[model samples]
Target: SSFETKEEQEEKMEKSEQAAAAFPPSFSVSEIKNKQRRHLMFMKFKQEKRKQKLQLKKKKKKEREALGDKAPPKEVPKTIENQRVYDETTVNPEDEEVAFDEGTDEFCSYFNGLTNPKVLITTSDRPRGRTVRFCEQLATVIPNAYVYYRRGLALKRVVPQCIARNFTYVMVVNEDRKVPNGLVLCHLPDGPTAHFKVSSVRLRKEMKRRGKEPTEHSPEVILNNFSTRLGHSIGRLFAALFPQDPQFVGRQVATFHNQRDFIFFRFHRYIFKNEKKVGIQELGPRFTLKLRSLQKGTFDSKFGEYEWVLKVSLSAVTVFFKMQEELCCLI
Candidate 1:
C-alpha cells in the first residue's frame, strides 16, 4: 500500500470535518451526568409521594379507630342483570297467588297434631354419590331420623311409604350435577311442605382434627337469634326439634341461625380436658337451608307461597285455642 501525500491527507481531513458538522454534536460526560441526576430526582419525588400517601392512610385509620368506627361496610356483590323473569305474576300468577285461608287451618292442625316429629331423610332416585353420602350424614345429625333411597319412586308413592313407616317428616335430598343442592321437607298425615336450598355442606371427617382428647360433656344448643325479643320463642321451638338422648354423653353443640329467611345449622361436639378447657370437633355436616317456599298441606302446588311459615305454624294453634277460650268466657 502506498502512503497518502500531505495535500491528499489535508483534503480528506476537511471532508471528514464537513461531514461531522452536518450532524449534531456527540453527547458529553456532563450531559450524561445531568440526565442521571434528573432521573434520580424524579425517582426521589415519586418515593416521597408514596411515603406521604402511606402516612395519610395511617392517620385516617387512627382517626377512624379513635372515633369508634371500626367496622367497614360489607360489600355485597352486584347481581347480574339478565333477561330472566322473576315476577311470579307475569310468569305464573296462579302459582304465586296465595288464598287467605289456604295455609291457615291446615298448617295449624298439622303442626298442632305433631306429638313426635321424626324425620326420614331420603335421596332422589338416581342420586349422585355425594348426595347419597350427604343424606346419610344428615340423618346422623337429626334425632329419630332414617335414611332411604327413592328407587325411582315418585313423591306420591314415597309419601305413603313414609306415612306407613311412621316418619312424621320426610326430607328429600334433591341432587343437581351429582351434588345435593335442594331439600324438600314435608310433614306427614297432611301438609305444609317446605322447599329449601341446601349448600356449603362440610362433613365432620373433613374437619381438621385437633390433638386434644375428645370431651364427654353433653352438647349445648346455641340459638344465635337471641338478640331480638322474639328470638327466645324461636330458639325454644328449634330446641324442641332435637332429641336429648343420654347415650351420647359427649357435649355436642348445635348452633341454629335464622338470618335473611335462611336457616343455617352447625353441629359440633366439644372435646374438653376439663370443664374449663374445651375445644370444638365438628359433628359431621354443616347445613345452610334457604327457605324457598311453603305449601299449605301435603305439598300442594297451588298453596306454595314464599312466606315465614315455621314460626307462624308453631304459634298458630296456641293463638287459636286462646281465642276460643276468650270467646267461650264472653258467651
Candidate 2:
C-alpha cells in the first residue's frame, strides 16, 4: 500500500508538471505526444469534470432543501430564442388590422365552415422507397387525405385538376436520392403557397416503443409557437388541412411545434391512467420542416410574388446589417 501510494503521488506530480508546461495559457489532452498517456490523461480529466459537476449539483440540492419553501427560484438558462430581439410582427389579437386580415385571408372559407378540407398528397416524379412510405404515412395522419402518384406531370397542371376536384390543399413531397427532401403546399382556388426544406424524417418502423397504427378518426390539431404574421399565415394553412370538428374519441393529437424557425411534426396518442395521471405514446412518421419561401400565388416560381424568402449567401455580414437597420426602423 505504501509503495502504491508513492507511485500514485509520482503520477499526480507528473500530471501537474504537464499542466504547468502550458499553464496561464492553454493545455489539452491532445497535446500529449504519447497515445497511451493522452488517453489516460483525457479519461482522468473527464472523471474530474464529471465529479465536480455532480458535487456542484448535490450542493445546490442541499442548499435548496435547507431553505425549504424560502428557497430562491431556480435560475433560467439563456438561449437564442429566449433572448431574441423584439419582433414587431407578433400578432396582437386586439389589433383591428390583424383581426381584419385574419377574417379575410385566403383560408377564410375553411375557417367560416363553408367548405370541408380535401387534401391531395402526392410526391415528385417517380418517388421511390422511403418517399412513398412517407406520403402514405402523412395520408394516414390527415383525415380526408388521398395519396396519388405524380406520373411525370407538371405541378402547374396538377394544381388546376386539384381545384376542379374540389381539393382544398395540394401537398407535393419532393425527394432526392430516394429520400424525402422538400415540400410544397399550395392552397386551392387562389393563392399563397409555402415551400419547406424537409429533414430528420423517421418512419413508423424507425421509432422505438411507438404506439399501434392510428385509427380513421380525426386527430386533434395543435399549432405551437407560431407568433409572427408570417407564422400566423402558415399556422392557418396547416389548420385548414383538417376538418373543423375533431373526433375526440380517437385520443390522438397531431402537433406542429415551431422552434428557432424549424417546424417539428409529431403524432401522439394519450390515455388516462387515473384522474391526475396521463400517459402518452408516439405514433410514428416524425419529420422537421423549415420554411424556405412563402409565395403569394400558386406554385409559380418564375413570376410569383414572394411574401418572404429565406436567402443564404456568402455575404451574410451585409445582410445582417441590412436586417438590423430594418429592425431599428420597425422598432
Candidate 3:
C-alpha cells in the first residue's frame, strides 16, 4: 500500500509536470459560447420554417378535403389524402418534478471558483484509426475559469446535434475525460451546478426584454436548468438502454462535443427497413454519410435484416451488401 501510494503520487506529479510544460494558450470561452448560440439560432429558424410549411399544407389539405366531399369517389389515394389533413405535432409536456423533489445528495451540490481545464472532447474529423483515440493533455488553469484542451478540435455526434446541446446532464469536465474505475463522480456528491440548454439568444433576449434573467422563465428554461444534472446521469441511462447496440431505436446513439468531435459506437443495427440497399442520412447541416458494408451476412429468412455486423465508422467503413438476385431480374 505504501509503495502503491508513492507510485500514484509520482504519476500525478509527472502529469502535472507535462501540463505545465506548455504555456496556457489563451482562447475565448465567450466566442465558443457565441458560436454555439448561433448554431442554435439557425436550428430554431429551420424548425419554424418547417412548421410554417406544415401549417400551409394542413390548410391546403383541408380545402381539398372539403372540395372532395362535394365530388365523386376515387379522386386521390385516401392514405395520402388523409396524411395531408392531419397536422403532425409532438407535444412534450413539462416534467412534474421541478423543484428538486428530494433533498440534494451532498455529493451532487454545485461549487464555485471552477477551473478551466483541458480535456479531449469527442470529435469525428480524424484519421479513421485515430477517431476513437482520447486526448490526454488537458489541465485546469484557474479555479472556476475554463478548460484548455490539447486537441485542435472536437467531434460531433452521429445522432441529432440538438441532443448534445439540449442535454444539461452529467458532464463532469475534469482535467482528463478518461474515467477511472470509481472516481468519475468524485465531485458529484458536492459539485457546482452549471446547466446547458439549447435556446435562441433571440428567445432569451425576447423573454427578459432587457434584464439579467427572464422575468418569468419559460417551462423549457426550467428544464434546461434541471437537465444539466441529467447529463450526470446519462451514462447510466445510456448504458441501460443501449448496452449492446447503441443504435437501438434506428436513431444513432452517440456522444458529441459542441465544438469538438462526434462518437457513434455499437453502431451495427438493422432497425431501418432498407439495410440491403445503401442509404444516406444528413446527420446535421455540417455532415453527410454513406454506409459501406464490411461483410455480408445471411439474411434473416423472415426479417430480411443482415445477421453480420458491418465494420462501420463515420469514415473508414467497408460495406459489402449481398446483392439481391430477385431485384437483379427487375433491374
Q: How close is candidate 3 to the true structure, as a TM-score?
A: 0.18
- Candidate 3 steric clashes: 52
Q: Residue 143 of candidate 2: its Cα lDDT?
A: 96
lDDT of each: 0.64, 0.92, 0.28
Candidate 2: tens digits of C-alpha lDDT, residues 1-331: 5657887999999998997564333576688999998888788777777988999999999999999999999999999987998888898767899889988989888899999999999999989989999999999999999999999999999999999999989999999998999999999887689999999999999999999999999999999988898899999999999998999999999999999999999999999999999999999799999999999878898889999999877598898999999999999
In model 2, what lDDT does residue 139 have? Answer: 97
**Per-residue accuracy of model 1 over 168-252 as CA lDDT, tens digit each:** 7788899888878898877766655767788887655655662233244434566764333233323433554455443356666
Give the runs in model 1 whose Cα sits over 4 Å from its true position.
Answer: 1-114, 210-220, 226-240, 244-248, 273-276, 302-331
lDDT of 3 at 283: 21
In order of TM-score, best first, we have 2, 1, 3
Error of 3 at 127 (Å): 16
Best by TM-score: 2
Give TM per candidate. 0.53, 0.81, 0.18
lDDT for each residue of candidate 3 in 33-148, tens digit (9 for 90 to 100): 57876566557556766988999979877877889877445566567425544323312225344234222332222212122121213322222211121111111101111222
Model number with the top lDDT = 2
